[model samples]
Target: MSVQLLIAQLLLLILGLIGVATAAPEKILDHGGKALLALCVTFLAAQVRPRTYLKLAPYAWGVTLLLLVLTLFAGKGAAESGGVKRWLEFGPVRFQPSELAKLGLVLQLASFFSRRGVQNKLISVTAMILLTTGLVLLEPDLGTSVLTFGLGVVVMFAAGVRFSNIGGFLLALTLLALPLADRYLSAHPYILARVFGHLGRDEQVAVGLDQIGMAHRDLQLGGLWGQGPDAPRWTYFAAHTDLIVASVGFATGLLGVTMLLFAYWLIVSTALQVAQLATRVRPMRPEIHGASILASGAMFMIVGQALVNLAVAAGLFPVTGVPLPMVSYGFSSMLTMGLAMGIIHSAMREVYRAQPALADGL
Candidate 1:
């Protein structure tokens, strides 16, 4: 599973290199270097025990929350982001806490679910998800917000929490969100525009003239075989980050994109396999099995966010700026996913080491 996961990441990183090089040459070197650093972190994380990740889950989650809150007041983003505070700068490094929150919440939720007789487990998980989601949403990052929420939901359902219970909590959440609607109205015009415009509910907005429109044109220009690196294309903001798939489509064409999709399939499948192995090690309350929960949460987040990014680029969903994991050109995503991949590796290692008999399943 780790081998395949590595292969998948390498392929995606290569895709990132190609996409960034083609659309944003200035960012290619930085992208490559950071990707390498992230992979290094993953390899290093594998050296740690799975139980270590469990022990650290609470700390990780707490720190992530602190970061998320900190970002709201002190974070800064690219000029194109239109003053959205999503990143915190430190000396020479800056990153998005929301990205880190994805993995942090995953580990934290998994830890909570695994422990037996924890009171209000469901509510705890919901609060964690809500807090993380709310912060990202306040950043007005619709894409990461959806991804974080989806991660918690997947973990909750897998933990065997019933639908009715989920719905009840969701309703309560709705009540909480009702009062915050003005935040969206006052601070998220960009988000509202993308969503409403895509649905054709807004008549005054020129919907098709934005970056997404250019992304669509880039895809069409690539055709079945793609136009290669030298293709004539209009560069758009976030071509290397949010709209990377289209960049890949433009440079590599359908064939390249198909390969990219296959890479994702391999990755998601490998993650499932890892999760399966981990679950087997702790058949009863597998969530307590740190590696098992880690694998499961990581797999869901990867596939869920990947699907959203693909849908948006394919014109099936609104542009939500969700970066394709391992494939997007951003330090925060690269490092966060690197940690996820690393901890995932640790989980597999812990499982195999703890139960040598289970190694045969792999």
Candidate 2:
């Protein structure tokens, strides 16, 4: 991708994030740097062949896992807002290992599933899910953990695995997740509080559930044209980033939110088209479609996480602090997504090259 295109996209994303900046100029640079890194990493990844990517999967997973562990111990500590322990600092720069882990697991799983023999697919996918999910859950980042698991299952299904196994996996997973969910609710008082707040709990105000309530109210007030650009949403402290949906709703109303979601849906559909094209190629090998599978998973990771973040802002899901992918203010997230996009772009190029007719339009 040309620097011009990257710059343009970065600007659009920044314009949206600008609404929520506290310190204005400083936070913009911090976030912009991360976005630029994502773009750079993406271009680099796109240059590599799927086969080479497969070869590197094991190492990538290992390094990411190590970083997640180090984050638990030596992580530079979470940002000043709430101390979430989700970011790690490297000297002057801070990055989120969880974000990197998201992309890492997607690529690793694509490599893993692409190489699986039909007979061993069930066991192999199961093992990958267990290992990846365990590591992600340890990060205690529930949203990304859910996303990682979802990506693995989607790829396994696409690889022509038996539906019965997918069903069985879901059934068993439901059983396993039930207990975990119960334990989580028991331990995390805030989880239930958030849910209760969403349900219009009156007593929640004293316990700080008022944020959800206030956000919901703000959504209602954003009817039609909204409060206009850069409008204040007192309900959200930094309305542009974490509470973006509500932020947009407050400014542009329902129309802006609709457009944003539509853009995401379009990107996701494009990625699916790429995957379908790659899967239909002649002389098919697992490696041949590896890039496409990774691309599809990457799209899901971004779209799915963004939806979750939006849902939280809309008071649907409990807040997990996940950003709105390319639209959010965080630097690490922007860069990570740019990197993922670069990989997806690479896959698209490869798929197009295989068929000149399709290549022309792109």
Model 2 earns a TM-score of 0.84
* Cα RMSD, each candidate: 2.6, 3.6
User: For model 2, what is the C-alpha lDDT against the true structure?
Assistant: 0.68
**Candidate 2 lDDT, 1-362, residue by residue in tens:** 32333443454365455444421335656666665566667678678766777778878877888888887777655454333356678887788887888777777777877776455736666776777776656545666778778877876666566889889988987897787887765654555665665566646433454565566676687798777654554644445567666665666677767767766766676678787777667767677568677778877877778778878876677666677877777777877788777766676767766764764544
* lDDT tens digits by residue: candidate 1, 300-357: 7776888998888777888777788888888988887777777767766666666678
Cα lDDT for residue 119, candidate 2: 57
- Name the top TM-score candidate: 1
Q: Model 1 lDDT vs. the true structure?
A: 0.79
Error of 2 at 280 (Å): 2.7
Q: To one decimal, what is the Cα RMSD in angstroms of model 1 from the true structure?
A: 2.6
Total backbone collisions for each predicted model: 4, 2
The collision pairs in model 2 are 38-335, 42-339
